[model samples]
Target: MYRSVGLMAWKAVRALAMSMTVVSGVSGCAAVQPASRTAGAALGLDAYYTQSVGWAPCEEGKTGEWFAETLAGVECGQVRAPLDYRNVQPDGSSGAQTVLLAVARRPAAEEKTGTLLAISGGPGQTGLDLIEAAYPPEVLAHFDIVAYDPRGVGRSTPLIQCAGGLDPDLDLNADDTEALEAAERTEVAACVTDTGLDVLRHTGSDEATNDVDLLRAVLGEERINLLAYSYGTQIAAMCALRFPANYRAAILDGVVDIAERPNDMRLGQERGYQATFTRVASFCVGEYRRDGAECPLGTDPAAAEEIFQQLLRDADARPVPVRGGSPVKATDVLDASYTGLLWPSAWKPYLAALQALRHGDGTAVRRLADFQDSEGTNALTAITCTDTAGPDHRSHSQTARRRS
Candidate 1:
């Protein structure tokens, strides 16, 4: 996690600490509560709460080989979720459609305390595959570390893929904000309409929280301790709100209090980026940079942003050439730089990209910009669009893009 004067570094650090603390604590025993009595009772779920999970190796194609080698105990399973959580059968027998939620867990070495459910930041990102490597062995030693693919995410039943998987051609840097807004809205609307509104309509934070509760019942645990990052903090908070008794300790890092809308969160994200960009620019000209490398921006941190702004302007005119991919326009660069500043690990490379960008090669920046996207962008967009309630979030983009 990256931090600056205005941005909070503690959010990212706390998220990591949440992953680490399970081992240092005393072990907790499971109550083996019947699903019908706990999670099922709350949600009116039928057999879903009590369904025994048959833990298997990596769930065939769900996990990559790297995770299997890194975390030896990691196992994959699926929990069923209703398509429409709001409208369910009166008898709780069956009325709504169900989908499989890909789940991953690494059981504790000793007596397990309550399970630590790690919800990743992107609502669309897949945790079942990569979450095992994120924590240390000591962390893995204390409790069952669990992660899952929210409905419509990786390996989940009935994937919601756009016609070309988020349209790699959608550029963020169009001069006209209206054009960009229209393009974005049209693309997402097509995805929702094509994928069926019923499925897209159900991908809300409230519904996702129910899935979390269902997961608790599947594990037969009394309460689940939440460790969440980015947008996941919202989901964890929602769980805490809905099932207060079922939640143990919820650690929200990079906390997103976007109970209103993305714009509300976007305003704060802008502050975080401004602070991080200032820090990154200062570091670029500092002694820590690569040996024998000249500071590209002439050591004046104040003027550094002006230089970068010029780069965005220039790139917007003639989109920078990316290696073996679409040309990156100014909008792409903006999105990329914003994404890079979110994590500290990407800072060095981002700086390198900026340095190279000055010399006319944007491959590095373009690559970092591309890195902002994961396989789950469609899911992220869909869930984000449907989950939060407010005036359209994209209106703010017009204000951002209009700046000269």
Candidate 2:
């Protein structure tokens, strides 16, 4: 239910009409030096938290095959965060198990208001590309913009990946424990067999938000403002919770309320998704017009909702065939609709997808679903599974129901 936007690759994603088909996608300073150590001391952390970063021209199109060229004026750096925070030595020897949080930054056009960290949502998101795509020059002028690839995610050294790949055939039925456990087993086995699970065990939110503190220290900022989308909201809130003084400000987008954060997230999502989808359905059917033709769903919004729901059920019953690719199942359609629901700009394409679905075409849905299990989703799987317990684990009790 908490889909990672970084992995989505939703749009053509061109910066100034620069097309980014697959070109994929930090830090500072002195004065900057003593001020950095003081900030770390104030935050009650060690030297790594106060460590000065070596900033350099990003390896975009130069060295790392992963860095993209269109993200202009972005500088890269790597700062260390302890792999194990719980077992730190008295003299602050946590650096031995260190991992990197790759950072990208763009300085303010003139004067600055500390660092504005644009944290992307996902236990496994890469936020650097987002700074240029999501923020305008005006916003960037207010403060130096920064984004980071959290450990085990993109461009972070020794990147963690699953051996068997993500499971797309996951069943969402309330009664389907067998299918769910099987998927989890396959996923966990892959991580254990392919990479050390020990690293993944350390990849949860505690370390990530601590890494945020480490980052704040690197920038020599006493407190950092955050712009977080979706799951990044979780990270932001935790940062505020962990080091309230160090979080100067925060702006959250998508799944904003901290109370509705990801415990029984899937079930929580199902509770509200239908209402939101209905509103979209009503608008599309009532106002959508193309080529002077009647609205695709005609005039009845309820009928449109029913039609879409029926399609999902039918896909569950039997997969819908795509023209040249794999079949679109119920889960695939659900994924497409969920992807479209996150942003309003996607509504037009969503309408197109519905039209395609009506004609027994699975292309639109497949394209939307492709983002869910992209070429590099294993990190997402590993990080996400490591971060939160299963939604089903919380479904059986009164405490869970009350939390919902």
Per-prediction TM-score to the true structure, in the order listed: 0.80, 0.78
By TM-score, the best candidate is: 1
Please give the RMSD to the true structure for each candidate, in Å.
6.5, 8.4
Across residues 1-404, which tens digit of lDDT does each residue of candidate 1 receive? 12221123334323333443321111221222322325534445656777788777663554454243535666877787777665666566766788888888888887655577877667787666435534544445567878777778777866766664344666554487887777777767776676777677676566777888888878887677777666777777666666666765666656776444456667777787899888887877775355556665557889988888888788878877777777767777786786667676667767777778777777887777766355467777777667543436331111110000
* Model 1: ten consecutive residues of lowest lDDT: 395-404
lDDT of 2 by residue, 249-344 (tens): 555555334455454676666666777788777768656663353454657776876677777787778777797899998878877877777666
Error of 1 at 282 (Å): 2.6
Clashing pairs in 1: 11-254, 28-113, 173-331
Model 2: lDDT of residue 83: 73
CA deviation > 4 Å runs, candidate 1: 1-40, 59-70, 164-178, 258-262, 290-298, 372-375, 389-404
Candidate 1 yields a Cα-based lDDT of 0.65
Alpha carbon deviation, residue 369, candidate 2 (Å): 0.6
